[model samples]
Target chain A: MTTFAPGRKASSSRRHPRRGEELTFWIFLAPFFVGLLIFTLLPIAWSAVLSLFDAQATVYPTIFVGLRNYIDIVTDPDFLNSIGTFLVFTVFIVPVTLVCSLGLALLVNRLPHGAGFFRTVIFLPTACSYVVASLIWKLGLFNGLESSLANQVLALFGQQPIYSWLNQFPLFWILLVTVRLWLQIGFYMLLFSAALQRVPEQLYEAASIDGVRSSWRMFWSITWPQLRSTTSAVILLLMIAAFQAFDEFYNLVGAGPTARPPLVYLYNRAFTQQDFGHGSAGALVLTLIMVVVALLQNRFFGFGAADDDSPRKRASRKKVAA
Target chain B: MPGIGSTQISRRQMAGILGLGAVTPLVLAACSGPGASTGGGGSHPTLSQWYHQYGEAGTEQAAKKYAASYKDATVNVNWVAGDYASKLNTRLLAGSGVDVFENNAINIADARAGKYADMTSIIEPIKDQFSETALYNVQIDGKYWGIPMIIDPQAFYYNKAMFSDAGLEVPTTMEAFYECVAKLSSGGKKGIFLSNTDGGAGFSSTMAWATGTDIIASDNKTNGFSGDVDALAETYSWFRKIQQNGFGLQGQPSDWWDITPFANRKIGIQWGGMWSMPQAVKALGDDVGMFPMPPSGSNGTYALIGSNWNQQVAQKSPNRKAALEFAKWLWVDQKQDQEDWALSYGFHIPPLKAVAASASKLQSGAAKEFVDAFTKYGKATGPYYTNEIGQAMEDAGTNIIVKGADAKTQLAAAAKKIDASLATLQ
Candidate 1:
């Protein structure tokens, strides 16, 4: 203001010119930070404390139980069984989602037109609430009624309706898997499609010139390498989601002993039984396992890295190592 | 991204003040309730009441109608939906907003947490008016915690036409009942529908009790399967036989509580409630008949479960006296509302002795039959038997009946789990 530089921009001439912008930025973001602190961070911190107390029906605790809650949850056979359920879900959903989503992406990319329409159609299911979808699955589609879509398939083969596919053992898994796949596959497919679109065509042309005639070979040599990071992310997300599955399982099957995942188990323990102490402990255990899993994923896939680990970067890293 | 601060200050400041001024009155007023007293000035207190969304139509309006009749306070009836138990319990624990609520079961843990007010004082005066049996469910540790509203007995409502077509009598024994079911199931028609998902969930304690085993023994702490373990196993085995052979409606659209499955002709025999009889009779005409969960042997142990819903006031209510007074006025003092609530909307037995005696709808036909069976065999678990225990019982029953698990093993494990749950209460 006293003597403005002639060559420089007005903002650049002053030291720390963004001080006003910074304050304004904070003013805009302050409400969100306050909300996050109150809602999420505070509750998480409180849960950690609640896990150490003899919190029964009330969240407010009077007695300190130390590691007793943890001991009880760990030794509890039901908690262990829930882990098995989570593992079974992870095994079913992860790789299958990865392959199926990738396949859909490739097929849609090859389409001459209407790619957006197809993508929108597939992604629409992702917008559906889990509770609504679960009720429909439980009462409408997979319900044991003769008019149900599941029984209609059996009817097509000139057979009577199958028994409640929900309560039965092996058949129950089919309902769980199919409903989950239908809900999530479309969204993952979009992610893959976006990644596929970003992929460079030069690699494919090089592969073709190198006498790689088969599409399968080209995919393995070029498309496969390009899509590795996206595949890892999808796998990581699917695994995390499988662990967090509560709304669908709780709504559809309820707290079925053999079918309950860890979150559902924790919910029953916390909310149903009103043993918030044990439930909090079980929840922390699940959170720890998930954190460990995410860390492992980061180690294996270089996920969540600041810079993108694109194929060219990996090749450059290999060159540097050489 | 330009801030309002980039503009002149006077207009923005004035706008801010105007906005706050406009919102202040709106924020302060919460008296626009469904059944708020019109004549009462702003000096009167407002009491918040809660009720789970009842399946029957006009229930919410009837509740609000009853609330509107109360001139003492502005009573707001919050018709809660989806997981009402959890919401009510959480609110009660938080010691805010909730004043009065309706619930069928009270967990001992909640009782310890001071979620429920001790209604012994209110109920002690009118103790003789309520049905003696209905009093047992809400009584905890020799104290009444809730005011009984409706005595809902869940029984099997069957198509009388199908019964006559198959020449079947209402079986007195479980074995005979199985035979009747097998005979009725033919030509793609199902014999029974338990709303298999949760059908017979409440009767878990009854299963043990059927074999002279109390789920909670007289000692009040231990599971009571030690005496008749083998008998309980046989009962489970017989149920497995019934569930597998008969074209049992596995997973109907509606559960045992709802009348739709039985009324829709989906099953010949449906494990439905007495409230469903009017609808069933209307749908299936005079062709509907009723029976209890039949006795296994001559031991006189029929698993005729008598469950009820009750109105309770919160201990931490801001105006506890007013809330309790309103609850008493509606459920206890007002006999007409209780009678109307029970009989008009759905066929439930009036918990009040005077109302039940005077209500002519329950005197004859299927309603009379239901009353007679309930009188003879209707037994309820004590207040100590929480929903969690019931759930574990259902899980164990599912294992034995559907999954083909060994009953002895499953029963033992369930008993152990139940005992552990009881132990935590101590």
Candidate 2:
């Protein structure tokens, strides 16, 4: 009845466009939000709530025990022992892994030919699944003290090979550290290699012209300055990874008296003993330790030459000065 | 040139190429889930089974046979290759574990907290089929919490070649056992292969049973031997004697220690369970032979027998009755199938007396010697020691024998710890 102009129709089409945009926005975001809510967010929320109560393996009604789990775990000798074991593991693994991977990177960096092949070879262990590597170590190769490859190597000498390398203290510790070092070297090596490549050729050439013949001087003056961020990153990553060494110990060392990592100890408490509250408390403590360690490592060991203050740190100061 | 390029890039062409790459990753991840295999997951009822895949033929055959028989219900058997208890507990707590499984009694009793169905009524009708010990081992608090699927009775496997070479008879008395062990050792073959791993539960269980003082408490309602420290001390002293003699395997990783010396023909006497027999046969073939472990005093040969394989319906299972009915069919109706499965490998002993009788003839010669060890001298006890008491026995058994830990002090401490643990169970 009313004369509807063509321009009016076009203008009307633009009406309620905000609603259409909102619909499209939600449509695009729906899948991710649903998955996040279902998988990550819900479980995290449940774990936090459950951490406050006495939850057994079965879905029996939980009792609000009021921080009793945290207290018990702190006091328990077994949990304390596990903490000691984790400390030992970190002390042994962190420095060893960092040094070995760096050394391996440097070693391969000098290779004139087949550098890619050597890199691939070093990285091969990383590509093999942890579960598979653990099984291979447990069976076929290790076998027993008398027959294990290590024992056989010992047998070549005049020593009578002991039956159980895993039972003895320092030997067991060494074996575990070695296996871990083997598995982690490739991962850290790849990181160092990438960082080493990014290091400008000009820095090394400048150092070389200054008659810095020592490899040590070159590393400190040239290589290290460039790798500051990367090294800090690698250290933080390796520390976290070392603390999370569960699968290898779980599969290889087993739940025997000799070998139980902190994660394994926590797991045994939660599932084996059905003491979930205590287990969650242990996990929380572990998380706190990890966070603190990471922050400290970054703050102190972060890339630097002590000679001059970085402009970045000074800029924050300059803002306050202004 | 621009016109031609625009014409070539048709709407459908652009959409098709873009869509293919985007969808490929999603498709790949979907295919990576358990259901990707033709064997796993569907609308069909999946009967989840937990099994240890230590040996090749023993485990794989069982899986194939179970899958073949149960066409209507899909048998989803997850064979764990690591520490059986740890993995089983993880899956159970995750609330997505096997519907039916097997483990040692101590592990099962602990698992009864929430993971299993109250199978007291289910096992009532079929109670007479098993021996009293078998029945008792599976019962927790008057309820049949687990079905005794396989009886793992520890025994002494002797390499007939080595025994004959040493010209020693299977020992009957403690003194005689020592003499034979010494002779076997002097002949260059190791005297005994004693696995002291898993807190040496295997060796300690056999020794505790032989001494007539239960290594673990026999009742879940109370502590070890009702606070009988004297009895616990006596048993500890006896183990110390065994440890001092040539009868100890140094504490090592269990599986490797159990198999290596026995397989290499370096040991004449290997103490292990029925599960080890098939492995021995596979490694040494017909050359291997087995007998009941030597008796400790007049207590006679104390063979440690416990339920290895058992299944329970999930209380939360939607098809609870159907799931239980499947278990019954697998265990009771197919008792012969179980016997045949065991006989095929030449080691496993069936729980059913009828099946045992039928298989007895097939298991003659050295096999008879091993079966006799279980049949004649075997004794099973329920509510076996858990936690501290169990740890105490292991400490006394291995530490005293191998590491020279004082028998008296360690044993006394063990008894006290066990008494405390039992109090909680009560």
Candidate 3:
């Protein structure tokens, strides 16, 4: 059963074990790297090349345009407006999602029983496909048909239900925010709940001794500061999710100028119009913006970077261990 | 996309398998190529055919049956459901097993890129038998790129009983149509459904035609919207009001393509196509009726528009000659299959004039009315009106009506963008 393969352990005990472990580690990692190379890395590099061409109706680049696609996508008003939509969406969604999920986490955490039940109930929407959820929201709930559940509620109050929900400006935003929140709040709430459980019980006892008796005061003085890392992570995730939002805007609103985001705009430009050149350029630009935003977020929050790294704290920890 | 199952051969064998994630499936399906082309390069060559999922029952079966009957090759049919154009375009670009497929029309740009085989030779001899509108959809630069399969005309399909109950007449003008919507909407019943969202893309595209102007200018120079901007705006303003006020059905459980909302009496009028006729008649009996998109004024014109699905073979298909022969046989040579396609599953008009003329199911009642309307007012967007141009128009319509942007400003912006798009074509 002796083997010559680099990753395999030698049958002779005299052979070095370290080489086999190192080789085995690489062998196990090869599939993921291969997948990354083939699926992700190749397409991205190709997409970069595609951005500089006048390619249309085909994947392979034909005529070299040399940043013409970039110029067109940048100068385009619809694309600019989509960025504005992204900003507005992020501004509305991020803070609202954080507050709602945190509030729900607190309420669920305080429950004497059924915390697991409430958690499951809240988390179920996250399991459903975004496409399926968006379809249900558009076609079933907000379809604006007189017999639709939304309109039927209005009927119960003897009021006429006649508004075209998806087309209206404020209503469109309201419905979008609501559906997205419903789909994501449970998952974020669970994150908060997990962080909440990790907060030391001694902190609450110490806070009570300090005259911070009110629950709101106790949370603000102690719990809120303790959950800063989780909050920063949540905010970062939420911002990325907001930028990537496409299913609801597309399926519910049907690619109208009123609701289109960058992804939807890029999809239409590339797939719908068969203009791969511009689509690739537009995608790279959006990716650039996302990277900038993430960098800015890291600078502003300093969440993981600033935690307990002071020289005094390091010395104190060493003293305690000694 | 739809899994091409329920085939008479073996449902499990002809697998149009969907992969993980919604968007990922489109890429996976396209990248994987055609299904079950076993025995390729042998004496028995196989041709791969694809189709968008038709809402009509038995259409998939009919497609598979047509493929099975072709003894020259083992034809594998893939029935794609949503967003078929993207999937088809990606597949054609991959130069995989895509031998032949159906689409609204063969994209001239794609053909110019050498993706589509010129169908002029296949269609030339039988040109006289095809409908003019059908030919216009698949023809470009004086060369045929696709063979017309079916002419699906979309128009107003109203509930006869509901209209009568509301003491209304079939609207013949834009004003009367507005009045009908307002009056018919009461007691939990909606007036109309022009798709479930964006107030209907079909309605927006045909609005200019309804106002006595074609979608394109003379010699395919530019869009005709620049000719009559005010008429476009005023009509759109009215549409906005109808949509905003809830006279029209917006958020229906089903799309305007389905007549279920109409049949269930939730809507008095529905903007539907000829394909929904059989189900409408079966459910509502004598309750269904047909009409055109009403003219804007005394000076305006009646109009209707639909995507004419055309069949085309790929230049880089696995077996191009066999693929061409199969397309020619099923779409042109087999008169019985053509007639059955036109009449059996749904009420689509066969491209062949001979088949359309003999379709008995379309000779009387609801089907006849649909045919009459189509014959009189059927309109097709010019080849110049590509997706970019069409999207420019749609964006203008959406901005004006939904976002409440000034119509003149929106139209001007649209005009500028469309001019740029048209510039690319030349």
Instruction: Give the TM-score of chain A, superposed on the true chain A, for all candidates in the order listed.
Output: 0.91, 0.83, 0.88
Deviating ranges (above 4 Å) for candidate 2? A1-36, A59-61, A111-114, A145-148, A198-213, A302-322, B1-115, B164-183, B186-189, B196-202, B218-264, B276-303, B362-366, B369-372, B375-377, B381-425
The residue-by-residue lDDT of candidate 3 on B241-319, one tens digit each, is: 7766767776566677888878777778888889889988988988889898888844588888866888898888767
Residue A316 in model 2: lDDT: 66
Q: List model 3 lDDT by residue over A156-260, tens digit each.
A: 999877457877768788779989999999999999999999999999999898878899998998899889889988998999999999998998787768778
Cα error, candidate 1, residue A127 (Å): 1.1
Report the candidate with higher DockQ, 1 versus 2.
1
Best-fitting candidate, scored by lDDT: 3
Arrange candidates by lDDT, descending: 3, 1, 2
Candidate 1 lDDT by residue in tens digits, A1-322: 5976666775563644455566665656886897799889999999999999999887889899999999989998778989999999889888788889899999999999998899899889999988888888888898887889989999999998976676777877887887888899999999899899888998888878888899998888788878878888888899999999988888777786648899988988888878888888998988899999988877667667544574446767999999
Q: Which should have the higher TM-score, number 1 or number 2?
A: 1
Collision count for each candidate, in order: 0, 2, 2
As a TM-score, model 2 comes out at: 0.77
Off by over 4 Å in 1: A1-17, A306-322, B1-43, B198-202, B297-300
Best by DockQ: 1
Candidate 2 residue lDDT tens string, B158-177? 78787787788766655676
The deviation in Å at residue A105 for candidate 3 is: 2.5
